[model samples]
Target: MKTNANAIAFIMEGRRQRFRRWILVTGSLAALACMLCCAMLLLGNTIYPVQEVIRALMGEQVKGVSFAVNTIRLPRMLAGLFAGFAFGIAGNTFQTMLRNPLANPNVIGITAGSSAAAVFCIVILHTSNTVVSIASVIAGLATVLFIYVLSRGRSFSIGRLILVGIGIQAMLNAVISYLLLVGDQQDIPAALRWLSGSLNGSQMDDLPYLAITVLIFAPVILMLGKHLSILELGEQSATTLGVNADMTRIALIFSSVCMIALATATTGPIAFVAFLSGPIAKRLVGVGFSNALPAGLVGVNLVLAADLIGQFAFEVRYPVGIITGILGAPYLIYLLIRMNRKGSL
Candidate 1:
């Protein structure tokens, strides 16, 4: 009896520690994201020195700085912060649940779906940003559903999901190429720009849609985090413990898809923050944290760092996505190597 009691007490204490770690890590990431956002706003062309920017935040009388901070930079910074966080959290959710670090929305063609749709809209359909964004959301959700159905032949398999995803991605890339080839010469620049995955010209209009979507769906993602942790222990064990495996998987996938779709709609599929952040977060927190929150934090950090680097790293500015792809693709290789070396893959 005493031994059983001790075991229970130890487990309870461990759970407490885990919860504390989650809260601390999440809070710290949130703070860092905020700071990066402020820097993004204040360190641009026509930067309003830090003092005046702060005064503007506190509603003091700063003239040109207030206009620059509140009018111009604030919107872009807010867009990047929220969109980065959404992609990170959503990516982590998919990776942990599938128990595959490569199963992020960006990896498995959801972002590509958005990219394809946006490219088609920009090049072929000749639509504005609003139409392109809506199309991207619809296409993103549709892509996930299509992949899920195609992968459901014998039994649902990760291998199938991944294969279909890769196939679809290749096909989408071809279509993008074709569109650019045959597109109007004038429109080609616009389409090519979107394909490079930029966060430039992110106006206030882009924020409300994503902001509301993230705000509304964020609670659902948080609640699903507990299910994700259990689901990580194999589907059979999860089902044995009263978890509805199919329903749970569908719901989590849906939540993640929406987050990715919304973010891609705003920021043009900012590459592998989704693919890389969760595994990195796992390394940081060791085996204890499978909650998806930490992965999202790491995701936001990765994107922000990449964006800042892209913005001010050299004479010429690149889109945020290009920089992240360059950095994240290599990090992904390293992660796979380490995982393989340790027999963790």
Candidate 2:
């Protein structure tokens, strides 16, 4: 009786600690994201005061402030926030589910697929944004399916999936380059901007679908978080515990791909937000806690923050993707070295 009571108390204590940790990490990330969002709105060419920014957001007719805040800043900020959250969640889901940090959409060709479709539309077809977005989503799903088919032998192999994805990404990149070379020089600048992932010229009209995609799919992924955790316990163990690993993986991949594709369509695949958010969230939240929300928040922070730095950190402005790519490259190198050392490559 005494031992049982002690065990019960210990379990309760663990639950409490986990709850507290979740609140702390998530709360901090949320706060940082809010701060960055506000900064994105307020810190432009002519800095708007807080009250004026609020009035603009509230639909007031304050001439200059309203025009700047509502017409320009608000849409840009929303694009970064929503796209960042989607990228973060999707990337984190892939990495956590696959049990490999390098399994992010950015590294594994999912974003490349979306990019290829959008670039083809822009450079070859001269299509509308809606058409480009649809193409991107379809291409992303098809790429995932292709990778899965190629990687499947008798059972799923993470190594084969990643290798095949990398190869596909390379091929897609080559296609993008060829399109750029043969395409009209007048359109090359636009194509380059899209590839570099700029939030410039964001319109309020373009946000609804991306917002809806994240809203519908993010919850599904979050709801499956427990199953994802179970799957982390190896295939046989998960099967013995009555978790259908294949079904769960398919659901996760489908949901995550939808969110990622929409985000790439919206912001042109802002680099490294997906690849970096999960590890940062895990470090902050520690083990044995759900890092999904925190990871999303981290992504939001990274995108908004990188955009601000790109805009004002240097004399010449750079796109958000360039800054993030610069940040992610070092981490990628470090990861490769670490993996090589461990003979996990």
Q: Can you give the TM-score per candidate against the true fold?
A: 0.92, 0.97
144: Cα error in model 2, Å:
0.3
* Model 1 TM-score on a 0 to 1 scale: 0.92
lDDT of 1 by residue, 102-146 (tens): 777876888888888888888888887778878988998899999
Worst 10 residues of 1 by lDDT: 283-292
Candidate 1 residue pairs in clash (backbone atoms < 3 Å): none
The true-versus-predicted C-alpha distance at residue 338 of model 2, in Å, is 1.2
Give the CA lDDT, 0 to 100, for residue 198 in model 1.
72
Model 2 quality (TM-score): 0.97
Whole-model lDDT values for every prediction: 0.80, 0.91
Which stretches of candidate 1 lie above 4 Å from their native place?
A: 55-62, 336-345
Which pairs clash inside model 2? none
Q: What's every prediction's RMSD, in angstroms? A: 2.3, 1.1
lDDT of 1 at 330: 87
Q: Which candidate ranks first by lDDT, i.e. highest?
A: 2
Any idea how many clashes model 1 has? 0
